[model samples]
Structures are given as structure tokens and as C-alpha cells.
Target: MTATPRPSESGLPIEPVYGPDALDGWDPDEKLGEPGSYPFTRGVYPSMYTGRPWTMRQYAGFGTAVESNARYKQLIANGTMGLSVAFDLPTQMGHDSDAPIAHGEVGKVGVAIDSIDDMRVLFDGIPLDQVSTSMTINAPGALLLLLYQLVGEEQGVPAEKLTGTIQNDVLKEYIARGTYIFPPKPSLRLIADIFKYCKAEIPKWNTISISGYHMAEAGASPAQEIAFTLADGIEYVRTAVAAGMDVDDFAPRLSFFFVARTTILEEVAKFRAARRIWARVMREEFGAENPKSLMLRFHTQTAGVQLTAQQPEVNLVRVAVQGLAAVLGGTQSLHTNSFDEAIALPTDKSARLALRTQQVLAYETDVTATVDPFAGSYVVEKMTDDVEAAALELMAKVEEMGGAVDAIERGFQKGEIERSAYRIAQETDSGERVVVGVNRYTIDVEEPYEPLRVDPAIEAQQAARLAELRADRDQAAVDAALAALKKAAEGADNVLHPMRDALKARATVGEVCNALREVWGTYVPTDAF
Candidate 1:
């Protein structure tokens, strides 16, 4: 006798086998449209990997600007096509390194950037015109983007030549990440301003990478990830339209970020379902005519929360599986987490190994030769339909509650994700769910491995650098620019213009944020549980 089959992470029933019967009424042409066409379920580009492999962007940032800059240069030398930056907690929260709250945390999680000086050093030898950069920032995304533009200008690179993305999805922060500064109202306004600013100034730049990665890390199922993320995308579109922007003007540049787990089949289905749903929404609901506006382009990062600390080396296999899932799911860019990530910052050796994993996938594997390899597979099509239905149901609930922002204020998304996370924990504790090195193939005693440790002295060094900047810079100019920023924030003007001027005048990240914090108070979440 065989045991009962377990359900998938999204609670979809898994059968012993799948055949043509699984897709009884599925139409290949309608559901699985050709790549780069409307309802882009197969892949975004028609040629997919046939033309070129996905951008290998390993997320790397640690210590001071000088330290992180070296890592980037090394990555470029190793044939990395794009750069993804990870900012420290202080920088993410819009605080300077010298702030009281940012003392011990400086340069611990990622790199510390206090001002334009730090930004310049961060991209020292990197040619802004030649490389694409992605900054994993949220609350202060506009500020960071402005700093990058300033750096590019100093390097003689035109703003129009700068191409990259800023993770400007602050709604997810209120739900999961907790890097949010101002309340939802001001946050949405900032995002709208970014859409407008980037559309006019940096035409090639991706305005916002509306992200579901954080929600997944917080324990959302694949279905929940798609539903909430797409709902957020809807809210952003509505906000931009209300802000007097055309759908085609900014929608083409809007991108998404997701997490790829070891569940290969389900992940591929999730990506397909997400694309189909988004295309329908853009075409039928919003009436967008531009093909690019309807495309659901996204970046995928391997699930960091799934990495095991017990047997660190086993994480390499985990990352490889996760990376493969992302590729199969048709991600535009990918960042493979290092094996040592669960313990601490990745060492140079471990980081290289992580990049090598992508190299092997792009070069050695036959997975890239075909577009949407799982297109006609019975199980995949059925899974895609199932995921889409589940996600649409969740999205309907969100719509009934007004939209993503309203649902977020009521803690709907957060509550649902927390419940799913609790279920996962319960399953793991009961041994119903097996994690290779963590629960099932457990080792009694793990091998000792040295992980990368950030230097605590870097905090003091960053503080000293800030002090030097303050001493040498023109305080009056910084004050005037900040006052202009405050005026713009209080009024209807695009705050990024003055914010850029403020950073150009040597204003610290904390100062710029505090100026806005004064105008629009910080967010304080209400307990829903």
C-alpha cells in the first residue's frame, strides 16, 4: 500500500500522474501564447534564451563603498552582465551611518552609503553607461536613484544612458519587509513621482520593481505571492493614472521581482499564471495598447530563507535547484544566493562559486536552447491553470476590500501570509514536510566552516567619513537644497528634483529622509492579530 500524497506548498492536490486528461479543456493558443506576445505565459521574449541567456546578477554589497566597489569590479571581470546592489539596514531605512539608531548596524547586512560621496566610491571604476545596475532599496528608493544619476552625471554618462531598476515597491514593506518609513499615502505618492520622473528623465530605467519576494520570504504561498504582487501592480497603475500619467508612458518600464524556491514545477506555473493574469489586467481592464506595457518582465532571486545553516555546503545544491527553477520560470535576471548566506555575508570564494553556478547553467545546460520547455506538458498546463484560478480568487478578495493599499492597511495580506507561515512551520515540526539537510537528512554533528564576518570597525570608519564630508562641504548649499526638497514634498512638485539637488549639495541620507519625515510622519502599524 502507498501512503497518501502530500499537497504542494500552495495547497494544490498532487496526483500520482498527469496526462492529457489533466488538461481537458485547455487551449494551447489561448493560454500558452507565443513568447513576446500578448498574454506572455510562455516567456517574455520570443527567442527567450535562444537569443541570449538571462542576465547573471549576483546581489553583492558589504562594508564600505570601497569594499563593495571591489566586489562589483570583480563580478564584471568574471563576465557578470549586470550589477545588483544590496544596501545596509541603515541605508535601507534612510538613516546615515552616524545616526544613533544606525550605530551598530552599519555595514553589517550590506554596504553603507551615507551621501553622494559614498555613491561615487561605490561605482568608482564602473562605467555607468555600459552596465545595468539594480538597487535593492524601498523607502528611500528615489533618493538612491537620484544619487546614482548624480554619479553617472559626474562620470559623463547621460541620464538617458543609465539603465537599471530600483526596488521602489514600498507597499510590500508595510506588509512584510518592515523597511518602510512614511505611511502608505506618502509612499504611494513617492512611487507615482518616480514613475513620472523616470518616464521623462531616464526613459530606459525600470521605474519600480513591484516585488513579491519579501512576501514569499515571510511565508506566502506561490498563489499568494502572485495575487498580492499583481494587486499591488494594479494599485500602482491606478495611482499613476490618477496622477495624470498615461498607461503606456510608464507601464512598459514597470518590472517585478520574485523568489524562486526548489518547487520547480509549481514555480514555473506561478510565473506563467502571473504573466497571463497581468496581461489580461493590462489589456482588458486598463486598455493598454503597447505590447511592452502588457509584458510581465521580472527578476528572480533564489529563496534565501530556504537555505540551510546546518550543512552550509548543501546550500550550493539548493541554490542550483532554485536557480534552475527561476530560469525555467523565465526570469529576465537572476541572483543566486551563496552557500554561506544563511550564516553571514558571503566570502569572495563562496560568492564566486555562486556566480559559477549560473555560468554552468547558461553554458552547460540544454535548458536554454528551447523556449518554454514545459509549454505542452500536461502537468505544467494544469498547474498553471490551477495557480491562476487560486490567484484570481485572492485578487478578487483584495479588490472587494478596495485594492492592495486598503487591504494592506487592514492587514489582510499580512494576516494571510502569517497563517501560511505558521502552517509551514507546523508541517516541518510534525515531519510532514521534509527539508533535506534540516529535517530529513539531518547530521548529528555538522562540519565546522568559517563564514565571512563584517568588520565592526567599519562603522566608526563610516562615521569619520561622514564627519569629514560635513566639515569640507558647503553647509549653506545643503541647507538650501533641503529646504527646497521640503517645499516640494509639502506641495505637488516632484520631490526627486530637489532631493537630487540636496544630495548633490552633500546632504546625508538621514537628513533628506528626516526632512520628509517632518513633512509626512513615519508609519506605525496597527496590530491585526
Candidate 2:
């Protein structure tokens, strides 16, 4: 007996099937090229994972500097190839741990790094020149970068030799995260200054990591996340070009950050589409001649939102699927979320298991031997094309309305994201979208999940150390460097150079932010925008 097929609201098959015909118009010569070639649709480098595998980097930082540093070393010993630091709310908000606004928040989510002294403790034994670091900071990126550079100096490693990434993507901060401190213009100025400083001084450092991870985490659909993120990237390039910097010089060092969701093939298609779209934007619209400018190298973190507090072990399977999607989609670096992530910060035991998942994939799976293994799949190709076309149409709408910055100011992107978010939430609520442990698979699963608990003693220790540093360092030198920093901010000068000087003189992150706050004031977002 022939069975009747169900239909979806979009008029597609309910259980949609795909075949070679799906890639009928997708040209091999035009779209799918060798790895490392122009457009970079396949992969970034020719060897791909054949020569060197993607870096296994798990995001781990919490509590005091010493605790985070210990965890870093532990992860390194466990074969973590790179370090990704997660700062506490106080650090992200540009406040000292002792500040009244910082109470109870210090060391709760991530490490509390208040000054250069804290920075020193954070990397006490780790060699600055050897290991690459990525700081997931945005609002206080300038101050953090300054401290990082000073750390390099103290370690006798010159700025030019330091290699790392600073999440200096401030635009998404306003739209999704709300971690922004300064107004848009002044924030852009700070980002530009970092771009300029790193271009001239720290050649190996990634000046900015334009991120869409938080956006997706905040409830954006995969399509809207990539589209809006690329829009912000284009706006940044335009702003940099207008700042009188050569496109090729700084563009290559620019990187991206993305989230790996559990939507297997859909996530893979989103990543592939993102690369092609970014390439076109850089070449066709921005007039970028360098192929490096067209390559969209990104770091991927498994979606934290997908983890469920109930049946947390199920999250391991989800993260594994998401991590596979990231690798197949060609991520340069990957961070697999821990199974216990939905409950609290991961314990050492849980973090190692998450890292081992990546290790097994890299070594045992043999997925790395081939580049773009699914490039010719009708399903993948068609989905990639569709996503690219949809994103481009949205981008054109943005262009007509003035550009990313203008659109952001008008809240167009924000409104669209919010709408999409609402749609997804409604779907989940109505049982149309299934979240296994949370919604579909009903069970009173009361497993005693182990969560890494940070003691309150961390804050007191950090505060005491901060006090000691203030008393020990030369107050006059700190005052003088801060004055210079304020003067530079008042002028057209790049603030990083003077800020680095202040960091080197033992000025705290709060002091440096306070000095700038006095000059540029602080950011306050209106409901309209």
C-alpha cells in the first residue's frame, strides 16, 4: 500500500527528502573549488586537517586568577591546544571587584581580573610567547588588551611576537548581550584604535573577533545570526577603510566567532553559506583585493542553550553532534560545551570529558583527511545556496536603509532578531520544536550533576591582592600615565599605547575605565534604538 506523505506549512514535505537534483544548478567550477583558493568555500588552507588539525580549545575560566590559571594548566596538560579566557561580570563591566556594583558578581561566572597584577597571576607559569590565548571580552577589550600586552612585555616577549584574539566586537554587544559601556561612536573609536595599534605593533595578534555566538545564544535563528553578524563585519571594514588604513594590512588579522548548534546539517549549511556570503561582500562590495580578506576564519563554541538541566548527560550527545557540525563546516578552533553547562560552571572532571570528545573526533574519526567532504551533497549545496541568497537579500535591505550601523541605530536588525526569537520560542512552547530533555522526553530525572562551585573566599583574596598592588606600585607613575591616557582619548590618538603604559605601571582595569568614563562618559541605550 502506498502511504500518504505529510506536508509542512511551508508547502514542503513534512519529512523533507533531498537528492542530487537539489544541487542541479550548483556549478562545480564556480562554487566548489580547492581548499585555500579564492572565495574559500571549501576550507581556509590547502592541507586543511591533512597537514595540521583544528585547535581543540575549551572555554574555561572561573573564580580567582589562581583558580583559572590552574584550570588552564590542567587543560593544557590534558592536550588543550589553546586557551580561551572567560572573565567575570565585573571585569566585563569594567569595574573592580571591590566596587559596590560588583558585589556578589565577582568570580561568579568567570575569573576576576581587576589589574595587571591579576593578569600576571592568571598566566603566572604559562609562557606568553608559546601558547595562543583568546579573551572573550568586548566592552572592556581596550583595557584588557593593554594588560595582555603588558603581560607580554613583562614576560620579555615583544608585542609583535604575541599571538591571540580579543573579542572586540562591540556592535553585537548592544543588540544582544547588553554588555556595552560607552556610546556607539566612542566604542567604535576604541575598536579602531585597537585595530590601528595591533596593525602597527602586534602583527600576530587578531585585532578583533567579530562574534555571532552570543547573538545565537540570545535566541537568534541560525540565518539571522549569520546575516546580522556579517553585516556588522562589513560595517567594520568600511569604518576601517575610512580610517585611512589599508584593507589588506588589518583585514587578514580580523577573525570571527560562531556558535555550533544541534541542528546537524542545518548548522553545517549555515557555516558554508557564511563564508561564501562574506567573500562576496568583501570582494564585490568593499573592493578587497587580498584573498585573506575574503576568507572567513572563525572559532566555534557548542551552543550552551541546547544543554538541558534535566538528563544533562543527553547534552554530551548534543555537544558531540554540534562539534561534528563545526568540524565538517571548517572551524579553525572549537570549544565543546560541557554536559553540566546548563546547570553551572563545569567541574574539572566534566571539562576534561568535553575536551576528550573533540580529541576523539580529531584522531579517531578520520573526518579530517578530506576537505569539504559534503561539498557535492545535493542537500548541503542547496541549503548553502538558499541560506546565502536569503542572507544577501536581507543585506541588500540593510544597504538600502543606510548600512549596518544605521540599521542597528534604527533597530531594524534587532527587531528582526527579536521576531525570529519569538517565533522559535512559540514553536518550542507549542511542541512543534522538540527539546528532548526539556520538552519532549518526559522524565523525573534527578541525577546529582556535579557542578564546579567557586568559593566566596576568591573575591576576598582578589580584593586583598588588589589593595596590596595599589599600595606597592608608584602612585605618581600611575597618575601620570592615566593623565596621558585621558589626553589621548581627548585627541585623535590611539588610546591603546598609553593604556598599555598605564597597565605596565600597575593601574587597575577600573582606574583606566574610570579615566575614560570621565572623558567619553558612558553608554545608555534608548528603547527606540
Candidate 3:
């Protein structure tokens, strides 16, 4: 009896073996250019990790700002190179802790940041000038960014000195994450405003990390991920350009975020293809002349959806593999998911272990010595070509549908991703795909594990803090600033300017967002089959 060969997560057939024949017509000069050059398939930088290892950025935040701040300090102490903040539902949705809708979920998944005071406490002892922070907040990204800037100025860190990224990719929110606030047109206006604001104010900051991580988490294949993400990137560039900004002015600051799955070879190829595609799009399509604008620098997070709760301890191995893939794929930075993530929010120890995973890969392994280790591998090169071709096909479809926003409106990306997710679920359920500990390995009894639990009292405490903030803050100033913000949103002015003033005047997140909501209104998705 012969054994059946398995397929990749993208449904690509896995051959028994691949050799030089696999890439018969492949040209190294054209397909695999020198690192840091145009069509950057091999890697983005010339030295890659040889100069310095990818920034070990760990994603963390839970409970109150003080608690989350403790975690950040611990991560920094444990040698994390950067901070990636995860905001709770209320904060992500632009709600204050005291809002009726924010009840019972003040700080369950991440820190609840209602006002500048919460942002202040979140980075209490951490110096804003020194640490690079990545905040995973959409819909109200500009609001959170202004709060960060406010906190930085309070700490005497100039705007130019503050370096970080905001996952301000709202298109993905509509397609997968479902945290969108306004309709597409208004949402895009806000994003364009962010680009204009950042180019002038925070030159060192990565204005937007156009993300495909959430789409992948929602079950997009590697090709689909790159295609949809790049399409969204195209939309953003167009929006900025149409708003009278040169492509090079803000394109250099654009970054990307993606998932690093356990499928090492394909994940590597996906990253390579993404860079190549983005490089061409920027240079050929948009006529961007800056080398930075052509480079597709991205941060990678190990796939959380791949982790299994059935045998949670096995997730450590899974994370190690995913982290390795991200490193080998030449990520600019990385965030390794904690092993216990499948069960609950990562405890302090688990978070440390996750950071240690990246440390081990960086310091303990020789993989960092070379740039593009698999540059000449026949299989990898072929996979890169295959993935790029497939992604381009998907991108062309999106183009025909009038780009990402139009395609999204027509339910193209969402429907495609849903089909992919359904296929994967079917494969897993039918045992056609073996998820080691999930489906194949049987366990009668599970080991004892004490997961970190958020305190229920956090809600009341946050509400009290908000009450005090409202009592002590200059209400007149907040009202005036918010009025200006609403006026800006209603007109052609960049809203971030007035939005910053509103935040500086101690306006709450909900108040600022509500002011804009009054002008731009909210999004109501139309059903599309």
C-alpha cells in the first residue's frame, strides 16, 4: 500500500521531491535580485539579519493599563526589542470604559485605554523616545496615535523621535476583522489624513502597517493573503495620491503585517512573493522613485489560529516552527504567539517563553549569519514563482472589480476567504488533513493548567477612573476641540490636526469618535452573495 501525499495549506500539491528541474527556466538575476534592490525576492535588506537580528517584538496587553505596563517592562527587561500593544474590545472600537456597550468587557482581551490618562499609565515608566511601539488598533487608529503622541510630548519625546507603527488598515477590518467604524469613503478619508499628518509630524513613524495577518487568521490562503493585502495597499496609495500627496512622500513609511504559519517553505515563498509584487507595484504602477518606497518591509506574527487547544503544550513546538519560518523569510520584526494562547490569555511566564523563542532563534541559531538562505533552493524558487503568479492573478481580479474597496463592496474578497476557510475546516473535520495533536492524537485526560484570567472588577475600576477624568478635565476645551474635529470631518481638512487637539484637551476616545461618527456616519455592510 502506498501512502497519500499531503497538500499545502494553500492547496498546492506537494511533490515527492524537487530538483534543479523544478526551476528549469528560472533566472537568478531577474527573479532573485540582490538583496535590498528592486524586485526584492531574495530579501529586503542587503545584509538582512547579518547586520542585526529582526526586532523581537512581542504582542501583549491585558487587564488595566498598570498591569499591561508591567508586562511591557518585563518584556523589555527580558530583551524584547520592541513593544506591540493589543487593545481591548472597547478601546479598539473607540468606546470609553463607562459606555453602556463597554460593560463586562473593559479589559478582557487587552488593555482598556479610554483617554490620554490611560495611554499615560500604559507607558508609565517606559521611555517613549527609546522604545518602538506597535499598536494594533483600527477604526480609531488616528485617535490612539494622537494619544500616543500626547503621552510622548508629556514625556518630552518629540514627534520625530517617536518610532512605531499603527495597524491602521481599516479595509482589512471590513474584509475580516469587523471593527470598521465609518463607511468606505469616510474611512479612506481618515486613512489619507493619517498619511498626510504623519509625513509632516512623525517622519520616523511607520504610518500604517497594512495587514494581512487578520485575513490569514480568518482563513485566507498564502496567495489570497498577499493578493488582498497588496490590493488594500494599492487602495491606500491611490487614496493618498488622490488626496494630493506624492507617492514617495508617504509610501516610504508604509509597512505590512502578515502571519507566519507552520508551513515553512510556502510561508517563506509568500513573503518573498509579497515583496516582489509590492516592489513592482510601487515602481511600475505608481512610479515611486525612493528605494524605501519600493521595499516591502513587514512584521510577522506566528499564526495563532494554528495553535491547538486539545494539547496546548504542543503549541510551543508549533510556535517555534512558525517563528523559524518568519525569520528565514526575512521579516523586519516578529511576534511569536505564546503556547498557552489557545487556552487563554498568555500568562507572564508564557509570554517570556514566547520572547525566548525568538531570542533562541536569533542568538542560538546560525540562520542569522546569511541573507536569503534558501535563495537558490530549487523548490523554494519554484514555490516563489508559483505563489507570485497566483497572487497576481487574484490581484488582477481585484483590479477588474475596481480595486480593493470596490471588490470588498461586491463581497469578492470576503466570499473568497470564506470559501477557503470552509475548505480548511472541511479538511480538518474529515481527517484529510492531520493536525497532530488536534485530530490524530487522542488524550483521555488533560494536564493541569492555570491560565491567566482577567479581573471582572476591572470594569468598575475603569468606569470610576473615567468619571474622575471627566470631572477633572477641562470640559470646555474638549467640547471646542471636538467641534473643530467634527468640522474637519465634514469638510476637506485633515482631521488628525483637530483630533490631536481634542485628545490633547483630554477628550475621551468615545467622545472623539462619536464626534466624527456624527459627521461621517457609520458603516452598514450590504449583503452580497
Candidate 4:
């Protein structure tokens, strides 16, 4: 290893070091107030992790429903606290495995969930009531959530008792991930319906996980990611409120998902700033009276972008550092990236090791004993303030463009993200960013590590199952459910109720979506460039 070059000091930057004097203008007692207090900058919970360590949720799902179910049980036995399900591109975009557009992608990246039958097999022997689940679905989130509700009913789990999060943030899908199915206004209307439905039926469930992970992965700065994500959350609240839902009812169930990147201190401060900003928005801006409404509970995943394709083992260290930053910043749950993630989905061994990393942190490190350990540190505090101010400024710009939806529609958000992404890529290409095995200390030859490979047989098996599902269920019932669902979409009824009924009648994801498409029509994105 050679000595690293000194980082640029000419730019306006935080001082290298500071003492008590660094907080001269800042009130330590007011800012660092107790955890679980009003304006919870320290944490949403007073005991922090002393009462319970953050839920260790490793995102896992691949191949067929049976395969994903077995893996979920395996993770639980290995001490995972929650199950985070990842769906294949087909399911994510509202196509069934057998759909023509889904041909080559079924069961490749994540689990293939087509109908209620697949949902049943996915939760086979696993009780939905006892274990919390998180689904990473966006455009077709309502369909998936309906399937989940049906699965819970099948397992004798009442709707009110079901607990979990659904990443139903379709607006971000359009701006960042490109998984949208409808235009912005209709998409937002569907989300409002879900918010209203969940508040009335599923009290413990999170209707939407306003996510910033995709934004970070799309090359937004930490400040932009935090700001834009919270801004979206506020927009959702406004949408729901405009639909006649109370802020306290839906707000408490709203949660956030963020990425913890390799910028250790920046990531930590970003989380802290996120909490403070969200709390203020809920109370001061939204006029929420409930403390839970102000609590910015979130699930953190280690930055997948930080993982390197070369010498992927280095990702283990990167993920560990990012995971630790998430814990220190007071995340309620975390997903550590597997060492082999850069190359592909993790092999079983690598995934287990990633889960173990969180276990070691919880048991070996005494860091959990103290809440917000760096809350008052000059560097952390200053960074938090800097990020909060910068994010608010960016948000004001977004507001001037008529808020997040308008910014996204005009391609402003995507353009900003592209600019940041290009700058970072330029830095990496110029060797200014040292990505260990990739840029610096380049390993000329690398040993190959086993990666998770999806078998072509899995797709065949899934298609067969889809055929069997169609054969076993009554076609009349399926047709009726779809008709009802379409009618609901065309009317003022909440779509989740009709969708859940359709799932119970064994309607496939594709069927439910197609029916709604008849009423709502499809979205055609204007040239964003």
C-alpha cells in the first residue's frame, strides 16, 4: 500500500477538528435534548437499542416462491429479525411471470409472484402474524399489498394484526428507478387510496416506505437524498390529507427507507438531519399532534453503489462501516449488503456473513448502550446542520418548481441526479475517488468467488406453477374479480379492497393491473432528456 494523497483543502469545508468552542453558536442542550423527546434529533425512542437492537433485515428473495420461502425460514433461524422480500422485475412492473414482457426476467433477480397461489407458497409454514415483513415493490405495490393481505387471511392473521412495510413510492419510481406504470396524478391518487384504506383497516402496517435508497444509488448527494425523500413524504401526507384522511392516522404509519453509504460521517449526519427535519415537518408544517407522527422511523441499507465489482470481498468492510454508521445514527432497522453484491445477488455463504456482521455489532460492540453517541460531537453536529440547511434550500427550489411531482414531471429531479452522478463518475475515472481494488491498489489478477446463479429450470418451474394456478382456480371467479376491480378503479372506491378480494379469488398480478389499466389508462412518459 502507498501513502494516499492529501484531499483537497481549498474548497469551503468543515474544519478538520473542533472542541467545545465549535458548538459556540449552537445550544448543545436544546439540540442534543434527550432521545425520544419532542423534536427527536437524538432518537425516536429514549432507550434506543438498549431495549432492542435494530431489526437485522437482510433483503432476500430469488427464483420461485418455494425457493424464497425456504430462504426466509433459513434467515430467521440464522437470527435475522425481519424478512425483507425483493421481487423480480416482472412482478415489480406489474407483469405476471408468464407475460410476454416478463419472458426472460422471471425469477431471475428476485422471487416470481404471479397469483395468490404463489403468495401462499411464498409464506408456506411462515406465520405472517408473528414475523414482520418488508416488501420492496413500487409500481404494482397495491397489487402486491393485496396479495399480502390475502396471504395473511389464509394464515389466520387478521388485517389489523399484520405488521410490515410496503415500498409503494411510485413517484420515486418515475424519477429514479423507472418502474412507473401510470402518470403522476393518477399514481398519486392510487397512493391516497392505499393511505385511506390502511388507516381504516390495517393500523400497524406501513402504507408506504418513502425511499431515498434509489435516489442515493442514482447518484444524488447525501443532502439531496435526505431532502428529496423527506419532501416526497410531505407530499404524500398532503395528498392523503387532501383525500380527507387525518394526518395523525396515516402519518404514524408512514416510515422511511434510506441508504448508508461509504461516506461514514456524512451518512451518519444525514440520518440525524433526516430525523430532525421530518419531526419538524410533521409537527410544525403538517400540524400533527401525535408524537408517533413526528417520529421518522426508517430502515437503512448499506449503499449498494459503494460495492466494487473487482475483489468483491472488500464490500464486506464497506458494508460493515456503513452498517455501523446506520446504527450510530439511530436507524430502527438495517440491511447489510453482502460481500458479493457488486457482482451479483449474494451467494448463500456471503449472505449469511452479511447477517452475522449485524449480529457481531449488536453483541460485541457496546455502542448500543448509549443513544446518539455522536449527537453532540462538533463534526457530526456541524455536518448535520450543514446537510439540513442544504437540503431545505434544495427543497425550496423544488417547491418553486411546484413541488416534487412538478419537478419530476419536468425532468428537473432526474437532471439534478444525472449531474451529480456524472461528477462522481468523472471523479472515479480521474482516480480522485479511491475505490480500493477498482481504482487504487488495483489487483491485476483476482480470484473468482461463487455468485448466486439463477437456474433456467427455475423459470420453467414457475411457468408450470402459473399454468396450474390458472387451471385450479375458477375462471368465472377470476373474471368477476377483475371486473369488480376495474369498476372500483373507475369509481371513487378504494382499490385495495377490490384488489384484495381479487387476490383471494386467485387473480394474477397481471390480471389485476390490466383491469385497472382499462379504467385508468397507461402512462406515456414525454422525452425526459
Candidate RMSDs in order: 1.3, 2.4, 1.6, 2.8
Q: What tens-digit string does per-residue lDDT give for candidate 1 at 1-529? A: 7656558779997677888899898888899778889789998899999889998888889999999999899888877758899999999999999899997899988999999999999999999999999999999999999999999999999999999999999999988999999999999999999998998899999989999999999999999999999999999999999999999999999999999999999999999999999999999999899999999999999999899898989999999999999999999998899999889888888988998999899999999999989998888888999999999999999999999999999999999999999999998888988888888989899998888889999999999999999999999999999999999999999999999999999999999999999999999998665
Q: For model 2, how does the per-residue alpha-carbon lDDT over 1-529 read when each residue is reduced to its tens digit?
A: 5555443211123225677777776787688677888677888888888877788877778998888899888877766647899999999989999898998889998999999888988998888888889998998997887788788788898888888999989999877888888877888888888889888888898989998898888777777788889988988888888888888878899899999887766677788889888887788987888899889999999999878888988989999999999999999999998899999988877887898899888999978889877888777777777667777777788888887778877878778777767777898899988889777887875778667778988778878988898989999999999999999999998898889889889888899989999999987765551
Candidate numbers, best TM-score first, in rank order: 1, 3, 4, 2
TM-score of each: 0.98, 0.95, 0.97, 0.95
| Total backbone collisions for each predicted model | 0, 0, 0, 0
Q: Candidate 3, residues 1-529: lDDT per residue as tens digits?
A: 6556557777676566788899898888988789989799878889999999998887788989999999889877866658899999998888888899999888999999999999999999899998989999999999999899999999998998999999999999989998888899999999999998888998898989999999999999999999999999999999999999999999999999999999999999999999999999999999999999999999999999999888788999999999999999999999999999889999878987897899899999999999989888887888888889889999999999999999999989999998999999998999987898778986988888899899999999999998999999989999999999998898999999999999988899999989988998888887554
> Which pairs clash inside model 3?
none
TM-score, cand. 3 vs. native: 0.97
TM-score of candidate 2 relative to the true fold = 0.95
lDDT of 2 at 120: 86
Query: Quick one: RMSD of model 1?
Result: 1.3
What's the candidate order when arranged by decreasing lDDT? 1, 3, 4, 2
Best by lDDT: 1
The per-model lDDT (C-alpha) reads 0.93, 0.84, 0.91, 0.85
Which residue pairs collide in model 2, if any? none
Error of 2 at 348 (Å): 0.8
> What tens digits encode model 4's per-residue C-alpha lDDT throughout 327-346?
99899999999988878888
Q: Give the higher-TM-score candidate: 2 or 4.
A: 4
Q: Model 2: residues >4 Å from true position, as ranges? A: 1-15
